[model samples]
Target: MTDLPQELRLVTAIPGPKSQALAARKAAAVADGVGTTLSVYAAAAGGGVVVDVDGNSLIDLGSGIAVTTVGNSAPRVVDAVTAQVAAFTHTCFMVTPYDGYVEVAEALNRLTPGDHEKRTALFNSGAEAVENAVKIARAHTKRQAVVAFDHAYHGRTNLTMALTAKSMPYKSGFGPFAPETYRVPASYPYRDGGVSGPEAARTAIDLIEKQVGAGNLAAVIIEPIQGEGGFVEPAPGFLPALVAWCRENGVVFIADEVQTGFARTGDLFACDHEGIVPDLIVTAKGIAGGLPLSAVTGTAEIMNAAHVGGLGGTYGGNPLACAAALAAIETIEADGLVARAREIGELALGRLRKAQESDPRIGDVRGRGGMVAVELVKDAAGTPDPELTKQVAAAAHLRGVIVLTCGTYGNVLRLLPPLSISDELLTTGLEVLESVLAETRA
Candidate 1:
């Protein structure tokens, strides 16, 4: 709808004069704590290109951190939101219940993993969904402790901050965080040095048993394909073992699918990859095509444990967001984005692996579907290389490609291109990435 071209076209420098000027104004008007990855301001975005105010079209590989899986300004989402806005904006689902809200809940319940009877509750963000999942778990099991894994990034809220592992930006000085949260080791096959999945699970279980105790644990929350934790795919059998352990111990297993849900990981939910059915699934990001919406879907009995009216927010399931989510869901299903994601993953991973063959600095290449990443290292000894990661990302940005970095050691380059991105554009972005990596390494 915006008349911008779909290709990466650099008419000026990455952060051109207009963007630099706007950045100055932003510094004056916006809080310094609210950081940005790219300094360029978006005028329009769709498909795989983000047209900045300077008329430079940057190939979008991040997809707003995996939020626009259907692509920015998706036709279905735009149409749905337009119609919903024309009809009515919001009446607060809690105050004046609407069909859109119920419809979204139905969709989430039906879509999330598990054939057993389930229920869904809407929230405004991923953090809220995670928080509510913990509350429900505690209420149902009458337990006080929750287990989070190392390198996990739940959210920025007080409780989620406690769950999140990163310390610099997300958790520094943000405490005193909520209590009763414990950290356990996550299965990082690359870093675990031949540790079997079962062994990793046992190590984590031993820590939990010794420190937290099963009776005091209400939930064990994790990202199936750890998101901010460097897209670390646990070793085979890791998740299922944890799920079984939680079930046997009467602790709710919550899959924080906030970044991995909705086909981003080639599965509707990442937990589906291993056929691990969690007691609760927290979803957001890709659920609503850029709309602020999140959900906690779980077994009906566990979700119902919360007292009536114990959960909800003023804008939790805003009608417009519900409409957008429904449309996004339809787009994912009808367009076969799940299979498309796998295709994208194959393309990306193939490129990265080929690059890795020549570059020993690429420590590991891991991920599922569209969510893929390569960890950078300093040498054959495999020391994390954060500086090289930053330099490569900067190089990519200068070349009109949007890239993002992540990892516990800040030495990862993640690729989360939109499923709708064209092969031509996707190839171009990856080419830019390859060139950048080669240049940075040299």
Candidate 2:
């Protein structure tokens, strides 16, 4: 416990002494392809905060992009990982089977929504899980077309890039993406053009029918809650309608829960909120408490459609990651992190709404569970105020708090605090945000 600082202590500016040095070194040592939010250079992390090497402690609101919901350095995750490393590092689950791999898969099957018998396949990343999901869907239906939604961010891989909506950074100049990939409008309520949930579904489905034709559609992939696309939660009834359409058309429905799963949105799986049982669900991020792991869980028939030896990668189910996943799942269940996510949502939404009342720049504050966000606007007219949002986040950073901005317009401030965050810490983070907004607006 002593490894973590009691409170924030900013001796120098944000990057401070150690972090600045590390950043300079990183510029030379690390790949420039990657992006960073804060350069605090974590020395230790637990509960709701991260302690930087510069000796400054910060209330973590990003939760490492919703990857550490159970908290960074969770005791169970640490113990399990350490034990696994001591036992054996890598035997490749495919080459030499391990109980941890099968155990984690079993957990995913049981934890994922739906009472039907399920099967699970582990992967090295969310992108891999998504790519595999498409393969399974295509194989199951014996179709060639895949339908994705706009503003979606599946991954950086070639196949996923075609499935993803954005192109500037993720898909720029790398096109000639996979064939038979089609896109439709996402259920974005804030910009739904005044259409109802069912109407939005129709708009998307109509396009699918006209362009791709349901006869050739293999899968309809969607994110229950758009993460990088501004944390946009689909309008009510939108998902159910789309899922129903898939059922009637013989298209497999795939839910990309990489960013919204593992209690990030109050439910174990975001699809559960609408009682939507998708044919396949892709999961990652918070699953292994920050470890690199992902999984595709779905109905037995759909997943098994792939011929034997058609699936499985060399490092697909690394022993270390499987151990961490087991421990992480156990931690989430035993510690009641799911309920804690609800408490976080209630506290954060309550404070953010109050702040919005006083600040007109706050266009809208919305989200579920620990995954909340506040969209900034230029004025009462509700034009995105990306500049002000960036300034507010920068101000919060200087004040020893870490915040992240999302949305295509970059005006949405996403709050993904660890579910284990203390009430006091959570309140302090919210207060910091309020203070920053007040100062920025003034």
Query: Each prediction's Cα lDDT score?
Result: 0.94, 0.90
Tens digits of per-residue lDDT for model 1, 402-427: 99999999999999998889888999
Kindly report the root-mean-square deviation of model 1 from the true structure over all alpha carbons.
Answer: 0.9
Candidate 2 Cα misplacement greater than 4 A, ranges: 1-6
What residue pairs are clashing in model 2? none
Q: Which ten residues in a row have the lowest lDDT in candidate 1?
A: 1-10
C-alpha RMSD in Å of predicted model 2 compared with the true structure: 1.4
Per-residue alpha-carbon lDDT of model 2 for 323-353, expressed as tens digits? 9999889988998888999999999999999
TM-score of 2: 0.97
Listed in order, each prediction's TM-score against the native is 0.99, 0.97
